[model samples]
Target chain A: MSNNTAIKIENLSKMYRLGQIGTGSLGQDLNRFYAKLRGKEDPYSIIGQTNDRTSEAESDFVWALKGINFEVKQGEVLGVIGKNGAGKSTLLKLISQITAPTTGAIKAKGRIASLLEVGTGMHPEMTARENIFLNGAILGMTKKEIKAKFDEIIDFAGCQMYIETPIKRFSSGMRVRLGFAVAAFLEPEILIVDEVLAVGDAEFQKKAIGKMKEVSNGGERTVLFVSHNMGSIKTLCNRAIVLEHGKLVYDGTAEDGVSYYLNNQNNASEKNLLQRTDRIGNGKLKFTGIKMLNKKNKSVNEIIAGDPVKFNIDYKTNCDIDVNKLLFGITFWDQHENKILGYSTDEMGITFSNLKNEGYFTLNIPCFGLRGGTYNIKLIATVGGTKMENMLDNIENAYSMTVLPGDFWQTGKANRSGNMALLKGSISQHNE
Target chain B: MNKDEDWDIILKPKRNLLDINLKQIYQYRDLLFLFVKRDIITTYKQTILGPIWFFVQPILTMVIYVFIFGKVAKISTDDIPQPLFYISGIIMWNYFSSCFSLTANTFTGNAGIFGKVFFPRLIVPLSQITSNLIKFCIQFILFLIVFFYYLNSNAITPSYLIVLLPVLILIIAVLGLGLGLIFSSLTTKYKDLKFLMQFGIQLLMYATPVIYPLSTIPAQYQFWFKLNPLTHVIETFKTAFLGSGQFSLTGLLYSCIFTTFTLIIGVIIFNKTEQNFMDTV
Candidate 1:
């Protein structure tokens, strides 16, 4: 470890037992004890698979994190990006010492405070003032430290009138603001944050990001931030690392990391969509497959921004009850999870009645309006005319597509880096 | 990494089984104080009676014990007034019981906070012990009121061993904390132990001489009763305040030794369990 190295992680790994703990642990413990007595390795430790939630367990143990090595320099803002089960949180938990790793070690300089969540120990019945102290103390701040920054925290949270009100009475936005304010002032040498900004209103999120930027720019503190919001990662992080299947697959600049993560999502569509477990619905109707087609109706992975394209969504009705008022929708979202464009059958007053058990719906667009960027598609099907009460299916990121830049306004120059969508319009100059 | 490196903290896969990290615990003393204050302040919040519940629980238990054991069972109260006798034992027993039960759920109860934050996990159970001590002090005042009431009637005499009041409280606390720590660590692994613990404290109380004097027990059964460390502490409490119950030096010494052993074993197991209880809990 060097003086400039704020955190040095070496060969860190964590293995978690699957299924029920303690049910068959006694035998495993005995096996481990026997192995240790015979001067051999633990029997169960050697047999395990990677952390993949969608797969069936072939063994009783899985390595949540495996042989991870990374170094964070002082005053560096490192962003960690990964899929849902890619061991990002496991890595943070290890660095924060919430749980000990199964193997390897981490050497850290100065105090390390992790905001795996804000208001971790806050009581709902306590006033905001009281909870601030409690939350600060839980985040490793002394009472004197909290008292010194009490006015600043209240000012930042902007809940001066509600300081004496119990947090239960405050709006959730206010609560998150209060929690984030307390955490922002923690002033630990190494701060680990995990998606805490996913909550709170937009204004508070901007303030929090600004606070985080300020904290890292102090030239003495280091920060490790994890979020699914690619926009924040690109804006707030100087460097980023991408984890895939419990392994560090990419370590580079934030822009490159975001692009690497977005590009990696393209391969996930190769799996049969029907077998996807990451969907939300009542299971009345399910999306089985999605095909992106160019103007000639030939299936293509990449679509030009100004070109005509079509999306064919294959679905199957689980039961025979669906008849009329079917609302089928497809939404396009950027890598930052911002909804870019949405098209629904009801928008054109088109309804499919008495749908077949297994059929496909095609949405044709004369001009695809998305800019040149990778986007994800979410498929939604509802029975009750665009109302969410009878939502049959909602699958987020069911399909990933890359759009190439094109002249949408018939101009020779391609319009890039303006916004997510391009609008078709003609402006006439007035002789004023 | 070289040993000469000036890293402030080195997190490792396995620490010594007995590593309790007293320095870390000391560093987070403010958190412990906050936890204790939270428990004390929030437990009775929004209630009409507030901290009055502290006085009500023990007094109600004393009244019931006086009726059941004093009048119905005809068990001797060591010739001390029934209310005076039972209240003293009740206050002492209440402190230990509340502390034991509360600390026993340290791992399972605070899993949310423990999962998110890194601090000395021992601070939680220690806070429970401290908060319960505050409650015990409040109830002791009620006991003293009853003691003086009996004193004016000249019905009982107080002993100079009364100075052992603080020592008696310390014994009860250590015994409760030790056993609670042991059970808390075990309950994280085997959740069924939690159900046993709920009724286990009740069963253990009968084995101690809480409602009756040690003299009421037969000679053959005295050894088993004496084996319970609480037996000596409650007996000494009653002997000091009421001047009627027995307080042998050997019994007190035996209780202290038992408490020390339990605490050492409890801390060892607790420190070991806190390392990875989040994974299982």
Candidate 2:
């Protein structure tokens, strides 16, 4: 570990046993004890090893993170972006000392405070004033320092009415605001933040992101931020680390990392669509295939956000049905799993008539008015209030579209917070 | 920047198998003081009787013990007045029992906060111990009032051993904290232990010298009685406050050793458990 390097992780690995549930057997425990007694490395540290005596299992362990090697320089803000369950949270937990890695050593230079969940130490029974001190203590802040920053924290949180009120009485937003304020004021040498910024409303989120930017710019502190929000990651992080299935797939510039993440989602549509049963809901109903074609009937993976788009769903309803409601819903969710907009056939008054058996349905929309981002389509067929077919295909990313820069309202902005953009009409005033 | 200096404090990380950092704990002493204050203030904040409940609880427990053990069972109060005898033991035992029960559920009770951040996880238990100590001090004052009133009423004379009261209280605190941490760590894995902890403290009070004097038990059971370190602690507390009670330097020495050993082991296990206890907990 070099002094300039804020964090140095050497061949770090974490493996979790699948179903040999509970702690391992007494024999295995004794074996481990003996191994340690003899100064031998843990035998079970081998990847995919199982020590179950009765069962000759193929593989009993899943590596949450495997052989992750990286060096973070002092004062660098490194963004970690990955798909859900890609071991992002696990890595943060390991570094924050919340959990120990199964193997490897992680060495860091200074005091580390992880705002994995803001206000983590806030007690509902305690007043905001009391909880601030409690939260500060939990974040490793001395009492004197917390006292000095108390007024500033309350001002930043923007909650003045009930500092003495129990946190249980505070609204969810207030709690999050206070929590974030305490964490933001901590000023630890190293700050590890998970996707906690998604907790508050748009205004608070903007404030939080601004605070994060300020903290990173302080020049002596290092930050490891993990978020699926590409726009925020792009704006704040100088470098990015991308993980795929516990592997460090990409590590370099933030732009390349975002593009790499987007490209991975793009390629997923091909191989992932064929494995439709696994991708969609529990195998209650199976979507055999989904295809998007243009007016020329050629397969197109990308589309303009406001352009005419056609969706064809080939699904098999396994059960006999009556009063079946074939619900075709398109959910436009951002990379961070925030639902931007969702439209269903029922919501649109475009429900299909009676269908006797399982077959294919071709749904066409004249104009899909979504901003540029990856969207998912969920196809469901229910009979008599019982769902017979429900399929969610993320491989196609449902629909990958790009809304180009235009005179469109808020075109230059990265995030379109509003549900929809209305066409503008200007009135000229002639004054004497 | 030299890498050696960067990772200096962490590399050979203090073998704090007893991961409780006394220095770091001292650093957060204000937080601990506030937590104690919070517990005491909140306990009586909206109560009709307010701080009077502190006096009421032990006085009431002493009355019941005097009735059952003193009058009915014909048990000796070690020549001390029965109320003073029972109240002294009750105050000390109340502190231990409350501290033990509270500390035992530390992780389960604070799971929300524990999962959210990383602190010297020992802070919760330390704060709990300190807070219970404050409550103990309040009740001890009440006990002193009762002691002085009895003395003025020509009932009993206070002993010089009363000077040992602080040492006796310290022993009880350490013993309770040690046992509490051990049980709290175990409870994270075995939830059934929580149910036992609730009832276990009350049951263990019978085994200790809480209601009856140490001489009441048969000589054959004396070894078993001594096995419970708390029996020695309670006996010594009574010996220190009430004039006529017995004091065994040997017993106090045994308890001090037991408390130290248990505390060391508790810290070691607690340190290890806090690292990844969240997974199982």
Q: Best by lDDT, which number? A: 1
lDDT tens digits by residue: candidate 1, B69-113: 889988987688999988888888889998899889899999988
Candidate 2 achieves a global lDDT of 0.73
Q: What is the lDDT of residue A2 in candidate 2?
A: 48
Off by over 4 Å in 2: A1-3, A19-31, A34-44, A47-58, A265-268, A271-369, A372-413, A417-432, B8-20
Candidate 2: C-alpha RMSD after superposition: 8.7
Off by over 4 Å in 1: A265-432, B1-5
Report the Cα lDDT for residue B73, model 1: 88
Model 2: TM-score for chain B: 0.91
Each candidate's number of clashing pairs is 0, 1
TM-score for each model? 0.81, 0.79
lDDT of model number 1: 0.85
Q: Which residue pairs show backbone clashes in model 2?
A: A269-A395
**Cα deviation in Å at residue A353, candidate 1?**
37
Docking quality (DockQ) of candidate 1: 0.51
